[model samples]
Structure formats: C-alpha cells, structure tokens
Target: MTKLDITKTNRAIENLLETTENPRHRFMLQAYYRHRYLEIAGRYEEIFAPEMMVENPVYHFHALGLNVRLEGQDAIKNLYREWSETGECVMYADDEEVAVSDHMIASKLTGYQFKPGKVLAAVGIDVDDENAMYIYKASEEMVWPYDDRCRLVGEDVWEVDPDKAEIIKLDPADVITASDARTMLEPLIKPLPPYDEAAMRPRATAR
Candidate 1:
C-alpha cells in the first residue's frame, strides 16, 4: 500500500468536516475516518478478506448498549450482504438504514450507521436494536428462499391505473448469483490506497 501523507491527510479531512457537516454527524464521521485510516494502514487485504471481514466483529447496537453474540456475526454479515444489495434505505425517525432482508434478519434499527461522506461514507452499514425483527420472520424463508415478495411500486406518483400496471417480483437467489454478488461488492471491496490528490479532490459529488 502507498503511504499517505498523514499530517496532510488529517488536515484535509478536518477541513472537509468543518465545512460540510453538522455537529452530530462530526463524531460519526471522525470515527469513520479513523477506521477508514486503519483499513488504509492495513492496505485493506484483511478488510475485504472473507475469512477476516466479519471474523468476530463487534456488532454494536448504539441505542441498546449491547452487542451481538459470538456466533451472531455469521447471520448478521449475511443480512448485511443481502441488504447492501437490495434494501431500500430510508431515514426512519432518526435512523438512516433499515435493511429489509428477504428473511427480515433484524428490525427497528433505531439509529442505523452508514458510511460517512468521505472514505466511502466510511463504507460500513450497521444496524441497532435488530434482534426482534430477526425472530419475526418464518425460518423457512431464511433457508429456502421459498417466499418471494414485491417491492413498493409507483410510490411518488399521484395516481395509476391498476389494470395496466404490473410489478415484477425478483428472487434474491437468482439476482444475487455469483456474478451479481461480485458486481455489487466490487466497489466496496476495492483497495484503499492513499488518495491521489488531483484525482480525488472533492468536486461535484461534494456539492
């Protein structure tokens, strides 16, 4: 991995934060910055490694002051992967991410965590207060992909003729196949090299 100009990088991000974010989001962004820098320090081989990515990760529930059980990361990670691919993100109450896995892995993510504005929004998606929802879904849906459901259709429009419209239902198994999964994960798992100043200077996306 290429080494970053640490002092320069810190000053740059601090300036970015000062100008763009609110106080509440600052802490979240700083934490993301540190974690992102750590991954950068490690050159990201471990961060994206399947054997290491979720290996005993501490899944913290911000609202509950709790964490996932030892083996829980397996289910949680799977839920995360599926959610990243298909869940509709909503800013619920104060929560920002509520991933609706086909199996409903968790519920009531009251104050979810998404990536920050920088470093891929800190690129991690986590949920809080999630256990109750995992218990609500029938077990078979988790195992067999036996149930297929349609997403909300024609949400913003005022009126639609029901007779002419049809919603296409997708099967997660068919959609998240090997090729699709790679396509979805490629960007997230890309290497985190030091920023190339000219190439990465915040521009249109920031505004």
Candidate 2:
C-alpha cells in the first residue's frame, strides 16, 4: 500500500457509500464510515455508540503468533484507550479489496500505524531514540459481523503477513502525535442520520 493519506482514505469511504445501492449494505457501510471517522478523531464513545454496536461485542486479534480475545464493550474500549495514551495514529489504505453482504463485510488491506519510539520499543521493536516516531506497516484482514438491526456484533482481525511487516523510522520534522492528528481530521467528519432499525430493515413486498 502507498503512504497513509487520511483525507483521501476518508473520501473514498464517502464515495463508496454514494455509489452503493443495497440498503442493508449501505447501513453497514454507514456504521463503518462513522466508526473510522470517530476513531481518527479519538472519539471512542461515538465510535461505540449504542446504536452502532451490540452490548457484548467481541474482538479477536491475531499477530506475531499471539491471539488475544476481548469480550464486551468496556474491554475493547479500554484497549483502544491504552493505545491512544501512546499517541498513535492509524491509516487505512483506500486501494483495498472490500466485500459487503447482508450480515457481514470483509476486507483485506495494508494498514499503517504511526507510534512514538517508546511505544514501538515496548512492543519489542528496537529504537535508537525513545522520542523518535516510526510507522508500522502490515497486511491486515478484517471480518465485521453485523446483527439484523445493522449493529456491529464484533470484529475478527488478523495480521496475515507478519513477516512482511515493516517498521520505518520517520523524519523528525514529519512526526505528529495522534492528538494533533485528531484535531486536524475531526473537521472532515460529516453528520449522518441516526441509526434506525426500522429504516434499515427490508420491508415485506406485495405478492
């Protein structure tokens, strides 16, 4: 995947939503787009809004021969909060394969995570200066399951090609904390209609 471009990536999701016609698929995509926007803004509450996800959502994460399963909203939210404390930002590449169905959506893409050198080193990455920043690029596959109401059930993610992952040291001048990125990107988020289960459901047709 190419270098991370936050503006381009968010715009691609908007374009996809505009071109997609299926109601169910559109519901799922809307939820996902909102999730992505809020995530970059570090708005965890909005990302996990009551109408957007189930009560006991689960997350399966796999990487470096380690598998961790987090159950329930609090667990997942805390995990994200912990990552935020380190001031990291994640960018999803727009040129990736995506498949949407009635109850699930799957995608394979290369993702880049920008983290401070301290955070990277704690994860076993060698760093010359703890104050420096680095980018970790990896191939990622995600499976998102949605309930009948279009609420996300859970996320199943895998770092499929861990061996190919690259850690690149960033130039000092290019370094930006996640907090700064949130401020820069929050303005790009657009408001959408609240999630309505009745509106998203398929209505019965006349014979």
Candidate 3:
C-alpha cells in the first residue's frame, strides 16, 4: 500500500529479467510487461478483445477452492468484460523466469497472488510455437481467490468441490522450503534495514 511497495515491485521485475540472455525469453518478457501495463492503465480493450488475444486461450486455476479451468478467449474476455464495467484488476510478482527452447518458453514463477479487478495471474501456459502464449502468476505469498475470479456454483456462501477442495493460504510458512540447521540461520544473515550511519555516527570533536 505504501509508495515503496509500488516502486519495489517494478524494480523487482526488471532485476528478475536482468540475467536472461535468450532472445525468446527477452521478447516474451517485454511483451508481458507491455500487455500488463496496458491492462493496468485501463486499456483492457487493446489486450482482452478477440482480435488482440490469441485463439483458444486456456486459464487454469483453482476456483472456489476447486480446480476450475477456464478455456478460450471468451473465458478471459468475459471475465475482464464484467470487471471492466467496475474496475479491472492487476497483479505483480518477483523472481519470474522464462526458459526458452526452439519454440516454446516455460515460465517458473513464485510469489503468486492476485488482487481484485480482471488481472490473470498466469502460469504454465503455452499454445504451440505458432500461436500466442503468455502466463502470469501473482506472488503466492499474498494472492487469494476472495475476488471470486473463478465462477461460483451458487450465490451467497462459497461452495467447495469435494474432489478438489481447499481454502486460502496467506501465511508465509505455508510455502517455506524444507529447512535444515544450515538454512535455519538464514534470517540471521538477512540484510538489515537501510540506515543513515553518516548522520547517526558521533560527530568528530576537536581535541
């Protein structure tokens, strides 16, 4: 919510793609930013329309705590169309990667989470080399489905799919990697808060 988090997110994205040397990854990352910024800027028509979007786009995710896969441009367009009348959504993530091959690029993402609006936190998306494919994911650390991005079976309370039912996971511990003694001290070595030591240091006195 603070001004710092906004600037921090943009810088984080730039840093994430700084090391990628592949041409395909570079181009995709560029397009990713362009399309995303367009959405964030309220130009949803430019990217969500049938002509702008790829054919048969598939949006896969857990809906109302169930794995509900939304397919085709219609699914993505309709979702945005409805939200656009209200307020479209946007998402931001860090540590994003694009692994390139001869044709397709697979993205490895973390820190997924989504805010309200029509933003699609994409992931593991591909539609052949000749076709368009782009996947996004919010920081899993904070994103949730409360906005009801996925269609609910009924109104009022949320219903769970018995076969694939689950609830929100907002706690950091939920996604922590397996820990051992060596890694346990990570917090100890973590960088300290920024400081102004020059001002804090005692002024030299004439002696």
Candidate 4:
C-alpha cells in the first residue's frame, strides 16, 4: 500500500555525494546507503551484511507520546521485516538537511509515510474507507552513529512535530506494494564499490 520511486531517491543521493568532498563523510554515507535499496528489494540479509552494524545496535523512535526503542540486531531486523512486509517504510523525504562527522550522520527532513486507511484507524484516525490509501506527513530528524569501521552503531529518531502531523487520503489508484516498487526500483540502483580504507581516508591536503 506504500511505495517509492527508488530511481529518484538514488539520483538524489548521487547528487549529494557529488557535492560532498569529505572522504570520510562520503565513505560513511555510501557504506550505509545500500540498506534502503536492499530494504525496498526485500533483501534484509544484504542490509545487515555481517559487520554492517555493531553487536548491539539500537533504534530509538521518539514520536508523539511514545518512545520506542528496538535493541539488538534481532529486534532491529524484526522491525525492518515488519515494515517491509507491511509496506510501512515506503516513504520519502523533502527539505533534507544532512551532516556528517567522524562518528555520526545527522539528518533533518520532512518525512511522508504512506499507509492504508485501516492502519490509520487502528491508531485512532477516522477513515471513510479501510481500503483507501492515506499519507502521514511530519518533520523528522535522525542521528546515526557509526563505529570507526563505519559500521552503524545505532539510530536516534525524533519526530519533530507529531502533534502537527497531517493525514491526507489518496486516490485508490495510488496503491502500490513494496514488492512492486522494488521490482521497478532495482534497475535504477547503482551498487557502490566495496569498502576500501585507503580509498575512504581523507587526504593529507584535506586534513
């Protein structure tokens, strides 16, 4: 019931990469960027790709009156599995602001999540049709911390304005499954080169 044009998102990231000159920053972004593509493709195994994360990875989602934290790889994996299966993660962002450091990547954006009317109803939103599609929009920020190896350690997400979140119903024709999106988006995804410390190191001139 949710989808994204992966081609478009890929191009956006490529453009950002082109403008970013920091080797470490580019390295970290490139290292973790493939997860979303694999997620869309229903390839969760590749998303984790052994050593992609630390032994105990955590994800904290702070929204509205709720604070949810998923700890450990299993917990994180199960959540992603649920999102992929339910198509809840089929969303995009706008006005994105991203920053990188030796150990973290911070992002702020206006995020839009697509969901079925039924899902919204379960959350106490009144919907006229259970089968109808609806989109929820909110401003969000996420802090991603990685290890020296550039493996992700955890994520802290803040829903900046959940109280002001908006839900808009969409036409029935807008319905699209995550699997279908993956099929359409996979072709446009360009694989990043394998990690090479030598390649990722900041040059002496840059230092």
- Number of the top candidate by TM-score? 2
Write one digit per residue (lDDT tens) for candidate 4, span 1-207.
Answer: 334444454444566788887777787777656765666666676667654678888889896346899899899889778877777757666677777777888888777777778878887877888777777788989899987767888889899867898887876567556777677667755565666676565444232
- Taking all chains together, the TM-score of candidate 4 against the true structure is 0.85
Using lDDT as the measure, which candidate wins? Answer: 2
Model 3: worst 10 consecutive residues (lDDT sum): 146-155
lDDT of 2 by residue, 161-207 (tens): 78898888888666556676687778776665666655567444212
User: Cα RMSD for candidate 2?
Assistant: 2.9
Candidate 4: residue 120 Cα off by (Å): 2.1
Candidate 1 local lDDT, 102-170, one digit each (tens): 212222212222211221212231323222111111111111110111111101111112233212222
Q: Considering only N, C-alpha and C atoms within 3 Å, which residue pairs clash in candidate 2?
A: none
Which of candidates 3 and 4 reaches a greater lDDT?
A: 4
Give candidate 2 misplaced runs (Cα > 4 Å): 1-3, 196-199, 202-207
Q: List candidate 3 segments past 4 Å from native.
A: 1-12, 48-53, 63-66, 94-207
Q: Residue 193 of model 4: what lDDT?
A: 61
Q: lDDT by residue for model 3 over 45-111, one digit each (tens)?
A: 5655332245455555443233566666667667655544333233334564444332232443342
Clashes of 4: 0
Candidate 4's C-alpha lDDT? 0.72
lDDT of the candidates, in the order given: 0.27, 0.74, 0.34, 0.72
Q: Is candidate 1 or candidate 4 better by TM-score?
A: 4
